[model samples]
Target: MSSSAFKSSERKLEAQVKLNDYFQEFHEKFVETKQAFQVFKTKSFFYPDPDFIRTFTKSIKQIESEVKEMGGSLSRLIGNQLGTHTQKTVLNSMEDVKPESHVLHTVSDELTSEHADVLVKGTETESITPPVSEAGNDDEVLGSALVQEGNVKVVDVKKKLSSSEKKRGRKKFLGDNAVIPKRPRRSLMDEYVTAQNKMKSISEEPSTKEQEAEYEVQTIMDFKKSQGQYFYKVSWRGYSVEDNSWEPSSNLTGCEDLLLEFYKSRLKQQERTKTDDLNYQVMPHDANHQHILHKALFSHINNPTQKDYENSITLLASPKPPVLKSQKEIAELADKALSQKKKDRFYSVAKTLVENMIMKELTGKREKQLAELRTWERNMNSICSDPAKLAVENFVDLELPPMDFVYINECIAGEGVTIPSDPVVGCECTDCFTDHKSCCPNQMNSWFAYNKLGRLKVSLGTPIYECNKRCKCGPSCLNRVVQKGRNVGLSIFRTTNGRGWGVKAMENIKKDSLVTEYVGEIITSEEAERRGKIYDAQGCTYLFDLDYDKGDQNLYTIDAAKCGNVSHFINHSCDPNLLVFNVWVDCLDPDLPRLALFAAHDIKKGEELTFDYNSGLNSKQMAGRLPAQLTEQKEEGCFTPEKRKESRSELILKTPKGNRGLQYVLNVSIFHNVYQ
Candidate 1:
């Protein structure tokens, strides 16, 4: 009760007060945490509803906010208590006061329980659950409960039972009374046992092998029907009694047989249809008699032989007169004329006469017809020479010589020269006769010497001759005739009477070298249309100027012709060596946009130089119209020589030995010395 005792008692009382306040605050926080935890648990179910996700998230956020607030409050309270204790200690010599142990223990216990509840709720919510709607449905709840018990067997059985129960009291119908035997409700284990027994019975059946064979056959047949169609097949595994495991069936070898059977059946069906079609087709005898009679009667009325009758019919009908000669026939004649020697004149005259006759026959103009024919003949000759003229005009100042002066000779029967038969010596220019030693001694010497050193320049107009005797000059005397002029325009090398160019490539060309320039009028679409009329009337070959760019300067333009080219002589292959790319020679200058040929792809020394012209140029229609060789049925029919030649050309051009619509030819310059 003295001064010191009184101070001590005051300090004890203050300490006790501080401890009580701390306990109270801790208890409040613990209670709050416990309440939050309980709320979280109530929301977190085994199959938590999706709708509750937002609510759950909100609750968690709230709990976190409360925890932070509580922590701050606790720290402040602890700090204030410590400060009070320190002031008391400083004012008087006394020990610091501690919080109540029981209070701390209670707070710890509550917090631990709250934290455990939070973890439990999190885990429960995270587990797999039924969809939102199903989770809330009583039926789903019942089904889930049954499934969890491992008592539900087949899904079909459960569904059937569910349906029956739904309709039980609603219908007293006769169908409902026609009792479907009630599926005996069994535990999953019991149902599995039953299934195993049935499977065993099926496996042990005497006809199991036969059934398996039949199933395999059926599967194969079904597969065959679905060859080009998409489908899926179900495979079963064998049941293992010990492990309750299913093993896939083994050695499924009958699939091929089934496929063969299917194919055989399909083929038979096709054959049957073909036979029926043949039977239904008009017989040759019947067709011939009817066609001849029809032609005779049609001719009597139309009278194609008589121009007056044709013109009268045309005037009455006001229709365009029919062409007397087919374009195909004219093209054939032109090709033949180009190919022949002495007979070349005959073809030209014949083409002109035929064209004139056609015009006369169609128009039925008797007067001044001869004069018109003469004029047309002159025009036809001029137009035909346009390609040559264009070539010469373009190269006039290009350090190149005229094409007429260039003489080409084939090296045949060992290095001797074999002059071309066409252009027939005396036909165009005066015939020059020169012996091997006199006219072309250098050429003769070069052939005789066969030297390897230094380059040889063969001029355009050098005459070639074969010599039976060896040259007087030694092999070292390197003398070769330099031809007078340069050969211009595109020239193709082809073997005589061969389906295509023979095995050997033309000489004096190198790979990746410029071959020849295509020389033609750069006509606009309108111009082409106007000029195309003459070609159409004469049945001469012409090309259409197709606008590839449609105004886009970045793209290329193409000259597309309905008629074929030597490029068309090249064939199509799934695998091809040559590729075609448009090359502009003068890239820096726009005005000098000349087209130059480069190797489409790399070529071996002797390989044919070919390209897919259709590449980057074909329309969708053209692509689709290409024939499928595997699918087409071949038939015998009468064809003109032109058609036969075209067919042969196409066959040689296409890959895998089949008829193709388009043809392409090997560029001779791929093997020429100039290119090399």
Candidate 2:
């Protein structure tokens, strides 16, 4: 054969080898997936599928067989080009490239009984070296003998120190959180010691004046980029253009949601401007038609003819004494010009000035209706020491739950779910919030048991709903508690129970206090089901079926399994301090109500926060059991959307109408630890 032909044949062989490696890798992953599924099947349900092991094994063998056949075919194609000898050599090479099958044994061991030999022969692992027995039982001899056998290891266990031995000298810890445990009961002398060590925390709190001022971010006036830092010229609430000051990103601190909203709005505005510019064809200037900006800004003026347009430009172009106008005045004039966008280019050449004029968000009424789209709560990586291991994206001092997280602002309508348009044209009273109730569209009427500032009056099971942006109530409205970001201190803790992880209160939480909003990617039922299978195999599911209304058949689900907030850390408890509520704000869509988890009763600091999976309703009916699927009986104040197998009396008492069906029939056995 010619040299070129030989080189071509060699390239073909290389490609065949690459294909073989990929197929082998895929075959191993397939085996692992099969093993994972079998594990899930056996452990997830009380009565696991009897034929699961047989079926899984069959599937794995079939897939591996196909992979081998594919590799063989590729080998044949390349081998035919060379001679019969080359083909035999290639086939021989394939025999040596077998992937390890350890997963099969691991998965099969759990399923096997004394009578069943589930593990196949040749796949079984045996000890490479036989177990050695020492000639003597003496400790020194055994230890020496183990050392002599290079394969054996002699481990010397260290003796633990007693509390008394360690307490002889006072020790200092390196970490900031290190603390010495104290007795529960303290005498008068202990109080003196405590007083001597305590520092005044009052000086650390924000001043009364500062707290009273409702600060909000409206417009990003200017952006300054520095050597690793970014600063924004912010317009504070109740402040004018002249009073606006440049603030560091740190000063905005907990208001990351607002900053993200500002970013998204700017992006949208840029997109709209591009669309607007695209809509207009770049035709040669029609002198008769003035620029759109000029026309819109000075719409009060009469129609300008072609000659009059020329005169306006001439007057604007004329060299006059430069006026010392303030930035606020310039911004105001620009705001007027660009704000009134009636697309009749009054001054065609004033494109530069028009581009510079931006309408900020934090100004006037827009600041009050805090419903804009936000991007991030905060950059988790910047705040967290390790972000990959933590399930959530926000900074939490403790380890997060063993789950995935994705951030989202609002819940979207899932498949088969319908968002009802039952928006109450709420009362426009500025004092409705001040009074802690509203008569307009009086939903579930005995207004929520919240204070004038929206805090819970006492630990009660009443649901809380804040006045939406549609209402004329101001930002400080008492009904607007949930929207104000995380108000109570919370910590994501690793649960001691088999329930994985959960959230705990860092401070005492009153009854009806907002814990955290159950935020995550709002996906459709189809997408949810597709993901459900994968999550099921992994043995952890965070998909929540939204049943805020039973009238709507379209099932909606929030799959917080992947993307979620701190609420994902709140685990299920049969007797729970927290309860989930369907809160509607912004647009009144019945189908896409926000899942707000509030305290059902007062919670002590350091206590784990939990809510029943389906909240006193049957689990199968709502399919609300998460991760570990366990069916539970209904409890009192069962406010879930869908109720299954209700008797005639139960149905009559609990209809999905307004406040008429809001009565609670309390149950006693609700506090048991039955929830998983």
- The whole-model lDDT of each prediction reads 0.30, 0.44
Steric collisions counted per model: 26, 21
lDDT of 1 by residue, 225-304 (tens): 13232221323334222322211112222243433343344333433453323322111111212323223222222323
Best by TM-score: 2
Badly placed stretches (over 4 Å) of model 1 are 1-491, 495-513, 533-548, 551-580, 585-592, 602-613, 617-676
Please give the lDDT score for candidate 2: 0.44
The sequence of per-residue lDDT tens digits that candidate 2 reaches over residues 1-676 is 5558645654555564445445434543543454466456547444444355447656655764464445345434533444367544543443333211111112222231210111110011111111123211112111110111123344332354565653442133212233322211101111222222221232243433354456676765554545555566888777788878776554554454455445445333433563434342222121221232233333323344544543333323223412334566654454443433334442342332432221121122222221211112234323332212122221211222232354444444545555554455666767763343353324534344345545453223233456776677777765676667667766655454545557788788876567777866667667767887888788767776554453234345677766566676677666777766666666465446677777766799888887766453332212233211123322223212221232223221111211111323334232232321
In candidate 2 the C-alpha lDDT for residue 70 amounts to 54
Scored against the true structure, residue 249 in model 2 reaches a CA lDDT of: 50
Sequence-dependent TM-score of model 2: 0.33
